[model samples]
Target: MRPFLLLLSLAFSGLLAAAEVTLTNGEWPPYLGQQLPHYGVASRIVAEAFALEGVEVHWEFYPWARALQMAERGQRVGTAVWTHSPEREQRFFISEPVVESAYHFFHRKDRAFDWQRLDDLRGLRICGTLGYNYGEPFQQAERDKRLQVRRLPSDELCFRQLLAGRIDVFPMDKVVGFAMLHEHFSAADRAQLSVHPRALRSDPLHLLLSREVPGNAELMVRFNHGLAQLRDSGKVAQYLLDAQQPLSLAP
Candidate 1:
């Protein structure tokens, strides 16, 4: 009878242990957005991975900088889909890659742009998003005043300036750039934009679990296990495909 009571207690505690994790997020389309289906692919992936472990995620959306600040301050469980950085790794338990992004230069087709290195962009009018890191070399070039850059508040603005001939080139994620062009611009405008065959940078984005919050390290580990399982099941690739080509793909 005592063993049976012990089993009941354990089952009850197990049910009680089924908990929800709150995560901070921001707008990064086709990857994460408040309006997109499943809050975009990356957020969906995070939610599903946690679901596999019988955990639920409650998402909180904020400005990108504020999202990072809130998560790092342990106001939430973590932030999703951030590119790996050494400074971040020092403060958070970085999960295995949630997604990877390849950034390329977007230019008008008539402009015929090409570049082997930063020096090649010396004379062109470059546009960049404020608070974005294009990579170390690009940052160094900008810091040294070797490249002239006009900073904009968002990618849409940068692309608008590019289309208006006010900006010669903008660096953006390839999949995201194409998605934005298709969704926001006309077919005519889409024809005018071209991506450089070479990528500026390729980085894997991860879940940043705050070290300031005790037990989050274990949570990161559990999330990683579920993430690995999701990857192996081939759903991540399919989800990405759907996000990238929403028009033609049947989800």
Candidate 2:
């Protein structure tokens, strides 16, 4: 390698490091949130992936629905950590999964509860969070009058209802649920909650770049490339571990 060639490569890397991008985000604790370390796990992954491509990420936090809308309307570049659906696929260029997560029903330990299927939830009061899809099977059951679910504004409210005996069960991402409880509840309050053993559903979350934003198609390509590198190096798993640690903080 010639000295000139090495210098050119170094110069190019510097230029890439100077590039920046902004995206919309929302609260989904221990994963994506404004308050957590590195703004939570998923946020750190998304930021690091872009940084690998020399693109800095500036996040605009909002309600989950508004985050989607701002990105869908191209008011921002895109949004992070959304599950794919046919409607979303039509409007956005989806990146490879940033993280895989599963949801489980959280209940009060005082109340005996067990379920092999959604049908088992027949007479129980189920709490649903707004702007979330519990998947088609759960939805269909709710529509058919087999499951009773009441929608709420956030996971915090759902948990509050559960403690108050206003709701029998609430489905939440396993990590997010525990993370929220750990952050906001007392030891006694935490003791009162227990997650069901069976998972409700699992989904691979993604970064969505709206078609309305020019140059985003190519940006998606660059992002996926960076994400592949991140995964291959095993930092994705390490980041998740770090994000969950008791005193996880920005390094």
Candidate 3:
């Protein structure tokens, strides 16, 4: 009787555990947005991947920094749509690559500049989002004073500064930059901005589970397995296509 009761209790606990998994996120549109269908591309892929594993997901949106903090502290299971960094690797178990993004420089059409190498940015006033990791070379250049960087609160602000001629160039994800341009600027204003032909860097984004979370290692395994299945099934590509269609229709 005692053994039977223990087994029943274990089964009930397992059922409760399988009911849901929570993830933290921020408003990074076309990739992850609260108002977006399925909460945008990456979010859709993540949801489908977990669904394949018979797990339900609950997403909590917060400021990017706060979201990362919640995941790092294990206030939630993990944070999605994050780029892997050495520091993040130390604090979290990163899942398989969910998506890749190209980081490119954008400048006013009349202020076109060529970038063959990092050295070309010297003496330029560059704008970037606060708390973002552009890339190793970019960071090193900043530390070595190769260029002057001004950090702003959002991509919209960066573009606003560019239009006002307060900054020379800003680096942003290619897709995100275009989306922001459409969302924040009129047709005439958008026509004045152009992304550099050369990309500064390309990075893969992943879901990062905090080391502080119990059973996180197992969760990572499950997520990767499901993500692999989704990719193998061609669902990943479809999700991206769907995300782009809406943006293409944007005014």
Candidate 4:
């Protein structure tokens, strides 16, 4: 009887001491969030991949900027669906890209305008979520004062602002915009919005580790191995295909 109790105590202690990965997940639908369960393909894929290596993940959801801040502050270990920009590259270690995201402009169809280049955006109000970088063109426009940009707290807010005609254009990742529009927008709202034929930029999405996280190299290595296993097993492609189904983010 005493032996049985001692063994149980040891097991519980081990459980309590397990190496846990605390992750910061934001409410980016079809990528990471509670609003759409299976839609978090990247998050779920990473979680599943890491589990194969005996690593456990615990997630806390926050606004996108806050999630990035938590990870940077070491209050959280990592973030997903992150763009690997040079500025951010210096701030964090990045995993190999898990997916690619293209940037597109969402605008009201009846109010069409020829947005040929960054210079063409002069005097237009553009909407974007805080902490998101949609490549160089828009950034350049921002620097030149050619474009008026509003930083929303989330994608849902951007959609709402766009629907209300408060902003001239909403610049978002093609996949993310599509997912959000399908998940949140009403049929009427959908009718008003359309994607620009011209792409602003296309870049790969990476899993980012905060500078404060310990064992960065080892964590990245392990994740690479796990991701390789998933790719070899045909799981990654399947996840991407599965998450392609449309959802709305209309406010």
Candidate 5:
């Protein structure tokens, strides 16, 4: 009787655990909005999609690095808008990509930068987000003194500084650049800045779940399933299409 009772208690506990999951998010605009009513684009999408599956999500908005660490430590159940790489793949289970983005350079329209290659950025001050990864070439350039990368706390700060001539160029995802331009910059500022024709890389964005969440690997599967349904039903693409304005895709 004692063993039977213990098994019953464990079953109930597992049920309770499966019913609750907290999602952590960083301040990536249009994807995750820190100051908005709802977390933002990705958060809203994931929330509504998971609701269809009866999975409840608690959204916790935090800085990018903190959110990443929380997801890694299992304190936070999940993170959205994460790029897939070998290192990250080992640490967490990744949901199917809900969005795609291009990393590009934003320069003053009046200035002609000889940015033929990553090495061409030498001696020119380039602004970038602290936690953003711009692929191998730029990272190597930073190491070899071929680029001077200044770390800013956020995209808004980076672009504002760039406009003031405090930084020569700012690197950011083009979607983010368009959002920030509309949110923080005046019409005049928008006219002054232009995204470079060259793209650093195209990345598929995913929801990252820490290994600590109970059955997290399974949860990733569920998330991806919902994402697929949303895409098939035309919800996901419509969200992105709505956000894509004045932000043209690369030909």
Candidate 6:
């Protein structure tokens, strides 16, 4: 083979290799789920973003904790739709924000409460998802014993406990909480529940690439560029709107 032809073939192979990426995520409805259309909104946005760069994505769904572990160990290129944290920032190369989620406290309609600060949570038994990161303030309060928290395996169980008065309240993403209510409860049951009007916090979710992965920094750059293109083209906004459509809700 001619020397120039050999070089050209190797370059083509490298391009093909760089065009594929594998990612992991858990079932978080309206954001990501295997049964969802386009695998939910954030999934679609990530897909489109990579498509802009001629890259293809292969996604695997696992338990949230397991997925994060796999990504951290470099078993997958990255995981998507993760809330930012100082620990994650130190351990991974995080892409630009992919979605914003409003966290709110939910309780039975008959037991409504309001709070302007974390202090109000004192003496309350709050339910939390076992592997979720609900921001630093909430974690700190739990760690410092300022509030009592019961970690549950799933959101459905937490909602059941809340209704049965076993838990005072539970925090969840506004959309995700509503979707879970609609999925697991009767119309009457749903009507008996309410989310606090005040959001605890609004945090941007990002794709976190494991620092253990080779060339992860370059991959982050590619992802950010593609994400920026998606935003500038108005596709990200459209994806957000579509994600909230009733038809997209999980069963």
TM-score of every model versus the real structure: 0.92, 0.88, 0.88, 0.78, 0.82, 0.85
| lDDT ranking, best first | 1, 2, 3, 6, 5, 4
> Alpha-carbon error at 29 in model 1, in Å?
0.6
lDDT of 2 by residue, 130-169 (tens): 7678989998998798889899988899999999999999
lDDT of 3: 0.87
lDDT of 5 by residue, 152-234 (tens): 87788998888888888887888878877887777788888878878887888888888877788877777777778888989
Better of 1 and 6 by lDDT: 1
Q: Which regions of candidate 6 fall more than 4 Å away from where they truly are?
A: 1-18, 247-251
lDDT of 4 at 138: 74
lDDT computed for candidate 4: 0.79
What lDDT score belongs to each candidate, Candidate 1 first?
Answer: 0.89, 0.88, 0.87, 0.79, 0.79, 0.86
Q: Which runs of model 4 end up more than 4 angstroms from their true locations?
A: 1-19, 86-91, 123-125, 148-154, 164-166, 247-251
Candidate 4 vs candidate 6: the TM-score winner is 6
lDDT of 3 at 179: 76
Better of 2 and 3 by lDDT: 2
Q: Which residue pairs in candidate 3 collide?
A: none
Clash number for model 2?
Answer: 0
Lowest summed-lDDT stretch of 10 residues in model 3?
242-251
Candidate 1 wrongly placed segments (more than 4 Å): 2-6, 9-13, 247-251
Candidate 6 lDDT, 198-238, residue by residue in tens: 88889899999999999889888888999999999998998
What's the CA error at residue 156 for candidate 1, in Å? 1.4
Ordered list by TM-score, greatest first: 1, 2, 3, 6, 5, 4
lDDT of 4 by residue, 3-46 (tens): 99999999997775446698888776677786666538888887
Q: Can you tell me which runs of candidate 5 are displaced by over 4 Å?
A: 1-18, 114-116, 120-123, 246-251
Error in Å for residue 81 of model 6: 2.0
Cα displacement (angstroms), candidate 2, residue 164, comes to 2.3
